[model samples]
Target: MAVSFVQRRFMSNALQKWAYNLSGFNKLGLMRDDCLYENDDVKEALRRLPQTVVDERNYRLIRAVQLSIQKDILPKEQWTKLEEDVMYLQPFLKEVKKEREEREAWNKQY
Candidate 1:
């Protein structure tokens, strides 16, 4: 028996979400994507985001940093809720990765 794509994705997302909450970055007003290291793919994704989104991401990071230095997290009311912490950069990253893979595959065809 083989697991289906949707099922696999669902399980993977569940685990990811569980890990995200367990990591507690969201408690400090940081999204899961914010915790991602600044790799080339993430940089590309950030470049593709709209100005407003970029500003918001910056604000979140700054706030998180301030909270860390102060030895506190955002107030419970200010903490990023799990449902609200969407993967804003993931779609763009996926697109960038797909393009990279396609380019690699194309180059190999020569």
Candidate 2:
């Protein structure tokens, strides 16, 4: 049972890695988080990010757009590796969602 579980876990991670690489966005030097759809929560989260982080995100996005327009990809070495793709906006998004939920609940109570 444990062996099967381990195998499943390994396969799951391998599949995810394969899918991540296949997505092609990383080839343009964009991170997984960078590809997220900018919904209201994401917009709010982005608004709450620090200026430096926002600048970096904008630079990456601009560069990606330029690369797409040129029909080019970054060098393989420059691709965003799975190990380096951290969820920088997740905490902010989570906080925003939580605050929104709290506000909604308060409104319901009033």
Candidate 3:
């Protein structure tokens, strides 16, 4: 059972790496999280991010846009590696979602 679990984990990681590379956003120096659609949840999460992280995100986005306009990708050595693509907004997003759900529940109780 443990062996199967390990195999599955390895396969899942491989598949994720394959899909990440295929997405091509890394070529523009953006992380996987940076490519997520900026819906309400994402916007709120971004708003809650620390200033430094927010600035870094904005920098990456602006650079990506510039590269796109020039029809170019980042240098191969500068691409975002899958290992470095941390889900920086996930904690904030989770908090926002939990609060929203609690608010909804309270409204239902009233």
Candidate 4:
């Protein structure tokens, strides 16, 4: 099933909280937000997730797609389609980092 905005927000928040708790970062009121639009906070949280955790999460996502295929929820032709895109996780995180920096800079300019 395609993830809705609310579900995506929940996933992002859950991931961020998990990252923070795993990394021992103690920023107040950080865990309560469900918005992933805050790029800096998301980047920091993503950065804090252990390499193993990232890998495990990636594997789980891939496995979910695989199961979807098995259940005919997705076409088999599309099974390998996202293989290259999966590598974008790191670059995507970096993009979020850059966006965060830009946002902070913009905020400072005001």
Among these predictions, the greatest TM-score belongs to: 2
Q: What is the TM-score of each candidate against the true structure?
A: 0.79, 0.89, 0.87, 0.30
Clashes of each: 0, 0, 0, 0
In candidate 2, the residue pairs with backbone N, CA or C atoms under 3 Å apart (3 or more residues apart, or in different chains) clash, namely: none
> lDDT by residue for model 3 over 1-110, one digit each (tens)?
25798899999999998998899999998986788799988899999899999999999999999999999998999999899989998899999999999999999999
For residues 33-52, what per-residue lDDT tens digits would candidate 2 score against the true structure? 78889999999999999999
Backbone clash pairs in model 1 (N, Cα, C under 3 Å; residues 3+ apart or in different chains), count = 0
What are the Cα lDDT values of the candidates?
Answer: 0.89, 0.93, 0.91, 0.51
Using TM-score, rank the candidates from best to worst: 2, 3, 1, 4
Ranking by lDDT: 2, 3, 1, 4
lDDT for position 87 in model 3: 90
| Model 3: pairs clashing at backbone N, Cα or C within 3 Å | none
- Model 4 clash pairs are none
Off by over 4 Å in 1: 1-20
Q: Is candidate 2 or candidate 3 better by lDDT?
A: 2
Candidate 2: list runs displaced more than 4 Å.
1-6
> Over 4 Å off in model 4, which ranges?
1-44, 72-110
- Candidate 1 vs 3: which has more TM-score: 3
CA shift of 101, model 2, Å: 0.9
